[model samples]
Every structure is written in C-alpha cells, then in structure tokens.
Target: MKKIEFYKYHGLGNDFLIIDLMKKRPAVPDYNKLAEKICNRSFGVGADGILVLTKSRRADCCIDLFNSDGSWAEKSGNGLRIVAAYFHSNYARKKKLAFEINDEIADAEIIKSGSKGFSIKVSLGKPDFETKRVPMKSNGKFHINAPIEIEKTKFPVTVLSVGNPHTVLFVDRFDFDWKELGKIIEHSKYFPHRTNVEFVNIVSRSKVVLNDWERGAGATGSSGTGAAAAVVAGVVNGYINRKVEVVFPAGSLYIDWSEKDDNIYLTGPVAFICKGEYLFDAE
Candidate 1:
C-alpha cells in the first residue's frame, strides 16, 4: 500500500479529504473503494470525500471529487475553492492553477476571510432549471409547481441542476424530523436517479432558510445544488425576487435567479481545515 498524504477542508461546513495524487491521469480503477476507506469516520481516515489533484493537459490542474458514497460530484463549489487556495497559497510559487471542472475552464482566486476560513469565488458557470436539461420528469426545460408523492405525502417540487440533480420544496418551518423524511424523499420514485431534497422557508423577499437531504451525501451541511434549487423554487412560486439569500446548515450564500437567462449564481465562503495522508488499497 502506498502512503497517500491528504488534507481536510470545508467550505461553509461542507468538508472533504483532499489528496495531492500528483501528475498524470491515475488509473483510479478503484476510486470507489478508496472513497469508502478514507471517508469512513470509524475505521478509515474520515472525511466527506476525497479530492485528487493531477496535472491536466486540458487545463491547469484537474480536481477529481468524490462523495462519501464513492460517487463523483461532477463539480463542487467548495471543492473548487479549496483547490483554489491550495493552488494559490502552495502551488502559486511555481504556477497558477487554471483548472477544468465539468469540462469547462475557469480561473480561480484565493480570498482572505480573517481566521474563519479561506474564501474562493468561482464562475460556477450557470444554473440549469429546464425540466429536460435538468433531467426532471417534465415536457419542457423547467419543473416548477410539479406534483409528486413522497411517503404518501403529496407536494409540489421544483427541479434545479448545478451540474447535478436537486429538488426543492417549500415548508412552513424547519422543524421536521429528517430521519423520517430525509431518506423517503431522497429515494422517492418521483426522482429517477434519486435526488437532493430541500425544505425552504422564505423569511423575506430576498432571504430564506433551508434544510436539505442530499442523495449520496445524506443530511449534512450546505449543498451548492440545494441552494440553486431554492432560487428556482422561489422564482416559479413568486415567493421572492429572482436573486435571493439562502441560509443552510453550512452558513449562507447569495444566489441570483436571472430572469433573462434563468440561471442561478451561488456565492459563499470556503475553508482549509487541515491536511494529512494515508494508505489506500481496493482489495
């Protein structure tokens, strides 16, 4: 077994175990097994997921992200920022990181956030709300005010995709039992690939509070997709203006719902918790 060094970081409160896998495209043949081992809090190194950094001929560097379930995130806002700081503070001495995520090239910057955490802002492309493009069960590109059943509970949901799938539902309050409702909605047949579920409470015309039950990550801190979903739900329901503030377990983020483009932009803070390494083996 090879000793792979790593670091643990958090954006808002979404944490990850990042690794400097070093140059060249690794055959990751068993990345799923690696994710399960390192992300395990009991018998493993412990983390939300693992990030592999490698030299990218397509871009500056490649950040391969995984969920605790060993599933790929496709793109991660927090992961991007963490990498931004990693590249800026450390790799900056030699080169600037112009990385590629989701096949899109984006230049990143590392921001100062006092002692709390390091803030990184990324041009997270655009938020897609179309029902079909967002891959929801709909005839068009948007899934707003759609009816679906979850554990015998009927409700309307809005679909949003920030490189991943999300479903938003407005609730009167944030006092529901997640243990009872989380898994139900996450696995509901209404969402084919399962989904990240959000319960939102609009506090003002521009601000709202929310709770989420993420599919692969389960219930935890903030989710970039969940925040984007809130903006989509707000615009369709006319609860608030297009741009809004969403408060989740991972602090707060500014999300803008562009009426002209129908894309949502999410902005927030990230952090570098710590760094470490471990031995990894699939068999």
Candidate 2:
C-alpha cells in the first residue's frame, strides 16, 4: 500500500482532486481505475474529476484529466484554472502560466488572488464548428442551429468543439425535464464520442443562464467548457453578444469569444477546499 497526497479545489461547484506528480511520482496500476475510486462520493474523496499533474516539456506543467466514471477527458476549463490556482499558490507566484493536456497547450492568467480563492482566465483556443472537428457523426459540414432528431424528437442544436465536443440548445425556459433531454443527447449516436450538452436560456445579449450535462459526469453545477460552448453557440446563432456572462446554479463565469483573436476565454473563480492523503496499491 502507498499513500498519495492530493489537493481539492472547486470552480463554482464543479470540483476536482489534483494529484501533483511533478516533484515525486507514484506507481499506479491504472489511472482510470484510480479516478473512479478517488472520485467516488461515498467511498473516496468526492470530486467531479481528477487532475494528474506532471512536468511538461512544452509548457510549464501537464495535466491528465479523468472523469469520475473512469473516462479520459481532452480538456476542462475549470480544471485548467484550478491547476493554475494550484500552481500559483505552491509552485510559482507568477500571474501567467501555461499547461499542456494531451499535447494541446492552453494559456492561463491569474486575475485575482486572496485568502478566499483565486480568479483565473484561460484561453481555450477557438471554437470549431466543423462537424469533423466537433467529431459529430454527420454528413453535413456544420450542425449550427439545426434540428437533430433524437428518440423520435427533433431538437434544434448548435454543435461545436471547444477542445472537446459540445451540443448547445437554446431554450425559452427550464420548466421541463432538461436533464433527461440532456442525457438523451449525450448518449445519442449522432455524436460518435459522447458530447457535453448545454441548455442555455438567453437573458440578454450579454447574459445567459446555463445548465450543463457533461459527457461522463452527468448534470453538474457548472462547467467552464460548457459555458464557453453556450456563449459561442449563442453568438453564432445571433442570440448573444461576443462577451457573455454564464450563470450556473452554483455561480457565474465570464466567457469571451474574442473577435480579434478568435479564441474562447473563460474566467471564473477556483476555491481551495482541503488536502489529504489517500491509501492505494501500487503497480
């Protein structure tokens, strides 16, 4: 048996357990199993996912993100900011930092820091509307504001990729069972690789309310990438402005689809929770 130290953090209510491997590495048989075990709400330290940190050759550090269900994730907006906060507090005090995930690089900036928590802005490159890039199994080029039939019902959705796949649906209200609809869309065969679903209610040109159903994590309080996708879809659909405020059940996040740079920037707060050690078996 071996003991591994981990730090906990939350962006809004979407939490993550960070295991730093930059200083010392541990031998784990399977990271997917480890993520499933550690992210269990009843048996282990509960979190939406886990972020495994290591030294990076291209950027300042690297992250291997795993969903609670033992699925590997390509990118996460909140996870990246949480890592930035983790780096700022422990490793360096610099305002700017870079992280590598699956050979993709993302730049982060610490906007605010205090005793409570940290606010960070992350650039998630640009939003891709190409169906091939979004990885949607479709014959069309783009799936923007198009009716996609699922389970005998057709839904108007705008699909895009902000590092990962997302399907955005603009709704008039949340009076219905959006969760069930989100689940259906997430598991639908239209998206070969399961996609995140965002139910957005546009309040104004610059503000909106978002409910997220992550691909592997189910319904979450907040999602950085989810928020970015909603805003991008809104802008493309002529509903929202370039800069929009995404309000989730837990809190709010700011997203900017920069016209000049053509990058999606997500800004939110990361709160430090607690740190502890977990016992595990080594390979």
Q: Which predicted model would earn the best TM-score?
A: 2
Which RMSD values do the candidates have, in order? Answer: 2.8, 1.1
Clashing pairs in 1: 5-277, 6-276, 6-277, 7-275, 130-141, 131-141, 131-142
| Model 2, C-alpha of 244: deviation from truth (Å) | 0.5
Candidate 1 stretches greater than 4 Å from native? 23-28, 93-98, 113-116, 138-141, 258-263
**Per-prediction tally of clashes:** 7, 0
**Candidate that would win on lDDT:** 2
In lDDT terms, how accurate is model 1? 0.72
Q: Residues 67-128, candidate 1, lDDT per residue (tens digit)?
A: 88888767766677677777765656333346777677755655454466665555456667
Query: For model 1, what is the alpha-carbon lDDT of residue 233?
Result: 72
Backbone steric clashes in candidate 1, count: 7
Instruction: Give stretches of model 2 more than 4 Å off.
Output: 281-283
